[model samples]
Target: MKRTFTEGLGRKELAEIKACTQCRECLRYCPVQEVTGRVEISPSEKIRIYRDFIERTESLRALITGRDIPEQLLKDFTRAVFECTTCGVCGEVCPAGIDTQRLWPLLRREMVKRGLGPVGGQAEMPEVIRNTGNPYNQPPSERYRPWFPDETEIAEKAEVAYYVGCTGAYQAQPMVRGDVLILKAIGIEFTMLKEEEEVCCGFPLFITGQHELLEGLVKRLVDAYKNKGVKELVCSCPCCVNMMAKDWPFYYGKELPFKIVHVTQYALKAIKTGKLRIDHGLEERLIYHDPCYLSRGVGVIKEPRDVLRSIPGVELIEFDRWGRLSRCCGAGGAARKVFHDNAVAIARLSIDEACHRGADRLVLSCPACYEKVNDAMKDYPKKVRIVDIMELLSEIIYGQNA
Candidate 1:
């Protein structure tokens, strides 16, 4: 395979790919490969195909042959590439430390260049984000409503501020409600941005490779918090917290002035310190599915579990694959758009694991994971309930209090 088509590799990208020793040690641990059992679709194989495209210019003949690659082929490739739940398991298992987690996105950028990128629902997000600053394409005014109905007041200069990411604003409305209930239950003093001043967290932009737009949005968010004297930031979305905590500092020259905490961590703190009293006695065999952005991206496996454990009579059964090694639900990196089947396949694997463990309910933290995995379980044997952890907490608290 005279491998000679490296056109997209700049000095940095070339150095990274060249560093690969072609050690297949990572193959043993990749969940996708483990599920599919095909080397051609493995991360290493994907990279090899990329290298061949870069090194062997002759491979361009595939495109030049004037034979249209079936939309399904492109869709499958995009799904396979982006389907990585970003578990970082392969990186932990790799002897050479190839860092496929980072490499996958770079490869996706190249894939997008060939118009073979994420399909279906995700296909429209990049354009929506670029145009309206949010993936849902709703008016920004629709974004600024207080997460709670009427109890909390917008402060002029609060010590803490809540950064409701896009999912919090739109998809995961219950999470927003849960957050408001917890804050109100504890009497924590925080102010939310007026509806007109709130902005998207730009996570959709970053994942879609809209770097320029992302940078601008990050600046806008950082400045908004800084100007408002927000010393702490509370977020309900793990993706938003991960980006603000890690990627923002890396991409921007400065660290954000405000500290970031996911709703789980904040809720746990309140419960532990007696700020909030949650009534226990929810008897259910619950399995917690760690969202990739929270567990692997931010090392937050225990906090969510700790909260679940606090509920009296709540039995938290550990899945065979969990924490940093959690299997993806097939929605991350726009995989739901590119590879709908692969996403469903991955979600099916997770559902089976939960069922095998005898879980009556599946608790998730990410809105995307909740939606994708829930959809996958439609044809599942048992009726497994998919719910956000916050939703469960709200139910437990309200049920007990009421």
Candidate 2:
């Protein structure tokens, strides 16, 4: 059964759609617009297109004549929404305070149910996760054992549990490895799920708007942690953390048994408690790239910078658009899989800015940004060292290259 244009949207979303003034202020900050220069795909244009569809489908004329929206118009809207990184900058800049990040996915969810979306390679994610327990379709056995630090001990059950999100476990191993190394260095007793016991957190599916599997996946993961007696859950991936904190309960139908905190937030707490020490220092200038999900999705804007600043003899550089207004690294919204060229192009914008700012290292916290920005670093005329905050800290403290 196909839903009407206005279905699935709540009062807030409806008012947001109705509130779009088409002021176009968000266009200047949109990374997609900055790179593609396609006004048709701009945020304001997307809202306009959706709003028009709602009016057309609901109008009295449509009921009398059995009118239908044009196929090309729907196709254009689908492409426009999926092409976005869902970075939420549009929402941050919206004069009417429309939450475009949240709105875009709801819009995409409607389209997905109508057999009209999850554009390009994104449509394959749900099936891939189902078959292999991850969006990357990699074997589950290879998730953590390959990179587990031998000397570190994982408690059989602990109050704190670390979630090695799919991206960090499979793609950016060094980042999660550093996470464990830091945990052990702080002497924090933490537990982890067995390699095969952990599954996708459903962020890929959620962001792409293929949400049928989200509830099952969320329940399974949440129950696993609950059985472990986990009081707090720590994750390095912002996408996973945001999903757990914001949407997991909606699916679980109650408050979660545990709290979810980012690795940076956890590490900062350790530092403040004197459980973790920044014993080593790097004498170099560094710029931190705030991952969109971490900075905006969860309002974790201060912890990462505070962690970076704690190290001795390090100068931190800020991107002109930092914190809530940070630019997307282009890998978000599942866009990188389909818009490979655009993903790299948008990532280069950040790298270019980092290099031009004369930073020796460009530090990142999210695995998605870590992977995509590193890919963008290749074949570029200039280079800035890309390192995850965990990796950088592990190297600084342990005196070994992470």
Candidate 3:
């Protein structure tokens, strides 16, 4: 079965769609096409389809003004759109300076308005997020208990708040716990929004075109944070950071009261301030995987590596694609939930790249990347130990406490 989007092709989008230069640089960096070798998933091809559609629509404007839109064009366009991970890597490489990352979500909004959106496993996301306040639909009580024990000294109100997003709370509990332990050992003043009070940042919803749900979720979340008196928010998830720093103000129709900072930023400061001293040393060779949302979305290319280098005896290496050219872990735009095999395949490319570089350990900042890359490396011949930066940092600071 195929779906088509026939609504909400705004004039601005139509005009910008004409600017594609056809240089195909975006296709060179697309994780989907790189892993799957499907030209249908090429970012260049996607733009070409949209361009051709606009050209045909303009030529037949008068005749089809009150008639049906082109169904075949819409079908082809929708398929190409969803095939993307929306990692923003394409936009970084686009010669025309087109923002394909933004374009994809806008197109998804059109797809949803016309009932062609959120195909496959993503169809049930709204209900899950609505009922559970999380896309995973896990019980709220089960969320924080795994990582945030009752004995942990989390204040009800504090100047700094640590937000462990859905992925950190549910999928990577150990990573979150390790981060908290390190924070505790370092004696930093911080608070946590109990899992009950925290909800999905709606990055998944926003990227998948569930605007109504996203708007409501944002209001509730921002309102909670505003009432909580948190002056600064530190996070361990890139998707949550991107949603808060990039989308929240626009979605809330006002500026946020607190500033958003990823945990790597916090970690870097802790290292410099002598709060998180590397009391112990671990000698290892590791490569850092820059989460797409962090590097391109938030423009944080060096903080994680800086944190790594600050530690003793840690050799921070890079793969062929690093910094601005860092590859995706195949987990953006909620693509993993919808395109599991393809997502793992994209992740395998990076895993192989890291292993081939002779990196015995792979350090990552995003929980989504951690989960996806770990899964992808299960059957891989190379035994690269995948660990989150926070977890590895804990080993050097808190030792057994992590």
Measured over all alpha carbons after superposition, the RMSD of each candidate to the real structure, in angstroms, is: 4.7, 1.2, 2.8
Model 2 residue 53 lDDT score? 85
Residue runs of model 1 more than 4 Å from their true location after superposition: 1-16, 19-25, 28-31, 34-38, 53-87, 111-124, 144-147, 400-402
Candidate 2 residue-wise lDDT, 339-377, digit = tens: 888899999999999999999999999999999998988
Flag the better candidate by lDDT, 1 or 2. Answer: 2
Candidate 1 lDDT by residue in tens digits, 213-271: 66777787788888889998888787788788877875657877879888889889988
What's the true lDDT of residue 192 in model 3?
75
**TM-score winner among the candidates?**
2
| TM-score to native of every candidate shown | 0.84, 0.98, 0.93
Pairs that collide in candidate 3 are none
lDDT to native, each model: 0.72, 0.92, 0.81
- Regions of model 3 farther than 4 Å from truth: 1-15, 58-72
On lDDT, the leading prediction is 2
Task: Say which prediction, candidate 1 or candidate 3, comes out ahead on TM-score.
Answer: 3
